[model samples]
Target: MPVRGGDLHVGVWEPEGGGPAPPTVLAVHGITASHVGWAELARQLPGVRIVAPDLRGRGRSRDLPAPYGMPTHADDVAAVLDHLGAGPVVVVGHSMGGFVSLVLADRHPDTVSSLVLVDGGMPLLPPPGVAPDEMAGLVLGPAAERLQMTFPSRAAYRDFWREHPALGPGWTDLTTAYVDYDLVGAEPELRPATRVAALGEDIRELVDGDSVQHALDHLRRPATWLVAPRGLMDEVPPLYPDAARDLWTVRYPAVRMVPVEDVNHYTVIMLAEGAAQVRPHVVEALGEAR
Candidate 1:
């Protein structure tokens, strides 16, 4: 789809059987992920059209230049909706994509009828004075480090993820396809498609910028935040820890937070178990929109 900077590659999944147009849902991927991240969830919702874009610096859009941040991503999403004539659709975002969803709702409210934030969009403050690069390192950990390394083969890349603490146990065909789509080059020179510079800027904005805060402050639409029990590393205490979750609840009482058990940040929308929990919420949101 043609957006402001360039043509963004989008993955569109329509209902299996040909029928009257079903309700639309604009699904957004995480910081380092692409549209393929939504494949598992899309398979479960046969009654909806799921449109996901490989955000400007990830997947097929890796060649897109700099100036990446939440606001720019929001504009791109709105452009996608306009191009597809799918406005007022339910917007579902996972991880950093959740932050993008909130900004989209704030900047282009008419394009979004409701929001489902899957383990993101809420505030996450880094320790005071952490540099942007350092913050990226802290937040993304191995996910960031992998971008700097080159893999000898696609199998090697798969092996790398197979050992990932969060993703390893939940690996499936959908997850494999998602990971395979992230690789850009050929043997011995293969690297993840996510642009490091764009990722750094996005991470900085996620922690330091006031865009998310402002979006949360002025939210007038129905929004639900689903939190996983673990972090990206599959460690105890999720990204939205108790203290953080409590503060968010007090601050944004209107945004409901639901705890999803037995899943980490990655599996929240990347695997079948997690998608099952998320599907009903998405369905309810879509039904309510009518």
Candidate 2:
């Protein structure tokens, strides 16, 4: 779909044996991920239409140029909703996409009726003296490293993920497809379908920009934040550690936080078990919107 900047790539999924038009949900993927990341979650919502976009500079939209940030991403998503005539839809965002959803609701309230933030949205303040690039490295870790490296073939790419501490054991066909779709370029030089420059700009804005903080401050819609117990590397302490979760719960009392068990940052929405946990919250949010 053509938006203000460029043609955006979107993935739409509807229930099998489709019936009357069901409620739509605008699902957004993480910074490095594409619309395919929402595949598992979409399957869980059997009767709903799930519209997910390859946010500019990621996935098939990788050719979309710079000037990327949360606000620009919000506009792109709004354009998609408008083009589809999807009004007041429930917005679901995972990881950095969660931050974008908050901006979407704030920028175009009429297009969003509620928000579901999965493992993101809350401010992740860097420790003193942490630069933007360093922050990106710290948060993204191997994901950032993979973007700069090349794979010999799709199988090689799969092997790379097969060794990832977080995704190795949790691997499934759906997850495999999601990771395989991320590979681009010719064989022996295949790289992830993510623009390093655009990713850097997005991370800079997300970590340094005050827009997300401001948006959450005045959020009017009902929002639920689902937190994974493990971090990006499948470590013991998750991104939102106990102390951090406690602080956020008290600070942003309106945004209810629910802890999802037995999942890391990546699997929270990309696996069947995690999707089962998230399904009810999405249903409840859609119900509230109705």
Candidate 3:
């Protein structure tokens, strides 16, 4: 693992018997998640070169100072890609990662040849208030605020996760490894590497405004929106009601939505279950564009 720009650390899982030019796939994790979030997808895509970098303030990467908003993150990814040799590769971003990918498209369109938004890419419903502070917690979710934690014992963390048996089916040790990757403070009392303020900025960028809400229908690129049927929702709206009109249906015609069955916000892209179906679609997108 090597650090670039003194901010991001690149950790790659090289595919066996595969050389460097295997249609590179850059895997950007969600809000709190690091590169490990895409372990399942990396494992499935055996031949391709999997480039997974720890986003700023998350895994192996050093956290930026407070007020680290979306632009900073998008620039960070662009730097990582440039470090990987100024690529025109596929960008697959999950959760908050998708937001960054969209920003990358808007900011550095040439670098990113195709976009694969895992469970997130478009602008989600904002918090009613006009203030970014109000939407910070709601947008980031539990992971953002307390993004990382190193437990005294992995078993202790495992036990903590056992409280919710529902996830046991799809998620395995990767989820556990992801939480423990961010080690901060003294050994016994480790904390998440990122600051809450920085996490807030990430959320703030997402709900900030019309910056991300481009006319998706005519964006003119091989971009796909792959979401779990019932992904993370900040607001309480009907499943298919009039108010939901502002969702995927009304806008983003070019955006292909794969309503993955038996998946939710966290597990859709983070967990292993969605990989079988999701990976092919994304790989296909990369192929279509490449």
For all predicted structures, in order, the TM-scores are: 0.96, 0.96, 0.83
lDDT string, candidate 3, 62-171, tens digits: 45544455666777788877777847878888877887788777777877788888766666665456465666555445555344555665455556555543344454
Give the Cα lDDT of each candidate: 0.90, 0.89, 0.66
Q: What are the runs in model 1 whose C-alpha is more than 4 Å off?
A: 127-134
Question: Which stretches of model 2 miss by more than 4 angstroms?
Answer: 127-133
lDDT of 1: 0.90
Tens digits of per-residue lDDT, candidate 2, 164-258, equal: 88888988999789989998899999999999988888887666577797788889888999999998999977878887788889989999999
Q: Which 10-residue window of candidate 3 scores lowest in summed lDDT?
A: 234-243
State the lDDT at 225 in candidate 1.
95
